[model samples]
Target: MPTLYLLKTFSDSTFSLDVLIGEDDMTEHVDVVVAGGGPVGLMLAVELRLAGVAVTVLERRTDIDPTIKAGSLNSPTIQALYRRGMLPELEAARDENMRQFAAFAAQRSGGGGPAIPRFAGHFGGVMLDRDTIDQDDPVLVEQAHLGTLGLVSQQQFESMLERRARDLGVDVRRGVTLTGFHDTGDGVTVDTDSGTVTAGWLVGCDGGRSLVRKQAGFDFPGTAPEITAYQAMATLRGTEALEVGWHVTDTGVYAYGPHPGRILVAEFDGAPRDRTEPVTPAELQAAVRRVTGVDVGVDAITSATRFTDNARQATEYRKGRVLLAGDAAHVHSPFGGQGLNLGVGDAVNLGWKLAATVRGWAPDGLLDTYTAERHPVGEWVLDWTRAQIAIMRPDPHARAIRAVVADLASRGDGATYLATRISGVWQRYDLPGEHPLVGRSAPDLAFADGSRLADHLHDGRALLVDLRDDAGLRRSADGYADRLTVLTATADDTDLRALLVRPDGYVAWAATDAADTGPDKYLGLWLGAPVGD
Candidate 1:
């Protein structure tokens, strides 16, 4: 057996941890250790700190990347950040004219009949122009701004998050990578580039190629796509029309819009290139000209990358003491820009749960629910992206089918359904039965105390909104006072009287009528017990 060693820190803050290691041959133990320091990892660290959990983040990169890979933030993700008081900074950086365009696509059917063009009406998608909009939106906006999504370069966003995590007292270490890990019964022994650290739980928030996931012996199951996408940012000269045109042709699909210095243009359905081959500026310029029907001069090339629309998800998100989030858990095509948003949501969901478990305020089963809940969501995302990718195929029959679907989508019901799905406004949990509170995100309602439902969740505590006549519910929860908040309101309050909220802002229990049940029975279940008969 390896010898055990303990590294003690002087700090006694709730977010601080004592590191354990195998000295020379010593083995040690700790509560939780996270791998990767990207946005997902940093967000998880900040969130854990906020929840009073001790966490350490290990990052391989010495510095943050300056390129803006993922640009759009979705509505649900914005709401999640708002609940934590982190949305304003992001909203302030949004573009003013960055709005979604709704349109219908019509294509003639290949059959030897009259042009059977199908029309799909407006589907909501955002035009993310970050640099131009950063000034007006600033990083701090009001709660009302939470209703919309914002845009920021990946590098800039990560920088801000790093600062925030440090400010929140999260122990972030760079130039450290997870080499391997061993799951001991009591905790996990993690081997890093610097040294070994032990923790009660290990979370993998690393990217698609996660060492932690691999080390944990988890399997990622999914299909790889045939066509690959090539993307690059460049300073190119384009006519006013060409600069604004979102073009598609027989060769490939291309889009051009104003970026910081030049036009940001991208091409999908391009042939794959080997990683060893250098993608030159001339090659990208030629491809752009071929697809756009415009000869644009490439002044400078910023960055270029190639990725396939492979849709795959981990078979499981959790393996014993090790959990996965972000790209570590799932990876799909970037068609909907859902990658980063989904990962951030995972961080938000798991962060509080991990914190609660570490603090002993939550049962172990609550930790298990993270994978059960998020894995299905990942599967759904992969399916959605696959459907989008299939439509992009250039085959005549596929185009004919797409035209019909587009036409149907243009109609009232089809349009509404497509719009809601694309806008990501229609996602709901699959609750077991028809309970009013089931499957719905807890709404941010106004309270008599001048606080909103989101205000209670901001501190990472489950809130029991009491509408009944009893004031005794508050007295009963006195023992769990620090972990629970009881809000009393009359039926006239309408909004606040209708729902009980979980820390993640989900409806734990709700009633259409204010007098449905006293706070005692509801509180018991919301606090992890079934209501007594």
Candidate 2:
């Protein structure tokens, strides 16, 4: 066992502590060491810290990446943050980003047409008409108020998460990269460019090209890329006739400004020879011209990156003590902005379970459930992006399929289907329960005391929400009171009689009457049996 030494420091009225792994060994120790400081890693750090777990985040970049990525947060991610009491901050960030975009548009277009049309999202350049959506759809009605998407840049979201992580005393070390790690039977010994760290566990959130994932020897198998795509912000000439939204041309597809000089073009011509090569203005200009058949001149460019439809996922998320999350666990096309949302979901789902394991109260195979629940979701995302790529292919059969898909998406039912999937309100884990609400995200029900369900979940503990105030139900949950919060409140909107919510906000069990079976069985399955029982 590694010996831990404690050191305390106080500065700026904020408190933080440092743990050293003995002077003789000169190794640092933490409950968890997360590679990558992006939104996924930071969110996981915040979640773990809320459970009082010591976490250290290793990031190679000293500052947030400013490149344009994942422009919106889906429903699940927004609700996850809302449950953690960060909804207000997220909304503020969205509003600020909107304001900045409006200012940029005004300065660039000199107050022309609307910056961008209102829409839920798109599939293969086919827009999901927001106006055609069925507001009363069963899967979506409960979350209608939160809207389909939260418009915030990846940079803004990461900044917010980083701030929360710091405020919660997470050791976010920038300018440090994970060189390698070894998971001994007891714990993981992580080697970084800076130094070695002994941690209870290590998670790789280090994007698609994850060094941790590669070093851990996880098998990553999937399809090869068929198209090369380019996204850039540049100074351009012409484009007088280019449309503002997505367009599927004969050669490929291209989407012009919602932001000035910001464009994305995809060509069916095979993947780039070298994706690592920095995209030049002329290169992007040529691609744009080929896709749109417009003589657009790219004078200057900034923030350009190459991508493909390559999709791959780890056969297993965890191998011994080293695990993977976010892009490190799965890689797919970035269409429909699902990457960030998928990663955020992974963090929320894993944080509590991993924390439980580290704290020594996790039920048998509790940590194993992380991959079981999230791998399917990741697989779904990969297939979803692959479907989009299929529809966007520049072939006669693909165009025919695209037309049918577009028509379907133009109707109420199809729009609702796309909207639910895009917003992630349709996500449900396959937990063991027969009730309709079981294994689904707990509805944000409003209580008689003016508190919503999310308000009670801010502390990152399992919640036992009792609508009927049954004494038997209360007694049944008494054993796990230390790790559970019981809220007795009347909710008018939901027909649910009672709900046992996991720390990740998924319903573990539901009861229609006080006479029904007690929650002890399900609670034990998830939170483990009562100590000394």
Candidate 3:
């Protein structure tokens, strides 16, 4: 086994580590080492720390990326932030972003138009209605009944998560790049530009071209790019006659947005751009002309980026003590801003399970469930992006299909289904249970005392919520009381008398008041044995 270094000072607080006593062999040791300090990495760090495990984040970049890659956070992500007690700051950021977007919309509409409600998340340029999507919105969210989505820039989101991780006492090392690593069966020895560190587990949240994934020999396989997409903010040399929204034409599909100079284009030329080359004004002008057939001159290219329908995913999320998350685990098009949501979901799913393993109370096969649960979700997202790209092709047949989808999305049922899918509320894990909500994300139920179910999850721990004073249920769950919090309350809204909510905010077991088993069986399945059993 590779030798681990002695304990090092982690934050300005009392802490301890079971590190191998060595000085020159290793510089530091932690419970977990998270690579790439994006929102996914920072979120994982927070989750591990919330479970009382020591974690360190090794971020290559010293500061946040400037590009506004992901425009907003979807329903599942917002609900997760709420569960972590991080909604207030992000909600304020969302409100500010909406104000800016509304102002831009007014300018485009020439003023006096109705203000846009802050929750219309679009998929393939189709606006998902907030009213239909979030009818059963997560309770206690800042958006309330409007929706569970939040409009915050990727930069803002990552910055906020970094701050929260620091507050949770995570040691974040900036400007440190991981050069290599060795998973020595028991722990991981990670080599970085600064020095060598040892940890019980290592997770790579690095971007799509993940060095960790490459070095660890994880097989990433998927379809090639069928279309090249571009989004640019440049000075357009034209008047305000351009109508905003997708314009499907005989040649290709192009779109104009609320911002005056912001535009996007898609070409079915089957030619992918060299991603290494930065997008230029000439290239942007050429792409726009090819798709819209409009020779709109570009005076300057302020910000520009290119993506493709290239989708790929790792065969497995974990290999021994080394694992992957976020872009390192999967890569897909930014068709509907699903990349960030998918990556954050991966972190949330892996965080608690990994912590359980590191803390030494893990149920057998608990770690394997991460792959079993998230791999299918990742595949679903890949297919989602493929469908969008297929419908956006410039051919006559594609336009006909697009029209049909547009009609369906305009209807109530179709809108609800699509919105639910896009928001990730449709994604319920295959947990063991017969209850309708057994495998689904738990709805934030409100109690008669004005307390909400989401309020109890602030500490990132599992909750066994008993709607009534049931000592039998409490006794059954008391064995694992150290890791589970049993909250007894009254809910007048639903008939659900009991729910076993996991740390990641998913329902493991749910039952109506009439069920005789109470919350007994699923407790051991998820939280392991009771304390004194």
What C-alpha lDDT do the candidate models reach, one value each? Answer: 0.65, 0.87, 0.81
TM-scores of the models, in the given order? 0.82, 0.94, 0.91
Q: How close is candidate 1 to the true structure, as a TM-score?
A: 0.82
Best by TM-score: 2
Give the poorly placed runs of model 1, Cα more than 4 Å off: 1-7, 13-16, 19-30, 95-147, 239-245, 258-271, 275-279, 408-412, 432-434, 448-450, 467-469, 489-498, 514-533
Task: Put down candidate 1 lDDT per residue, 4-89, tens digits, no spaces.
Answer: 66666535656455544445543334567889999899988887887777778999889995443776666567666667777567
What stretches of model 2 exceed 4 Å from their correct place? 1-18, 21-26, 100-115
Put down candidate 3 lDDT per residue, 283-325, tens digits, no spaces.
9898887777777888888778887777999999998888899
**Clash count per candidate:** 24, 0, 3
Cα RMSD of predicted structure 1 = 8.0
Clashing pairs in 3: 479-530, 479-531, 480-530
* Candidate numbers sorted by TM-score from highest down: 2, 3, 1
Compared with the true structure, the alpha-carbon lDDT of candidate 2 equals 0.87
- Global local distance difference test of model 3: 0.81
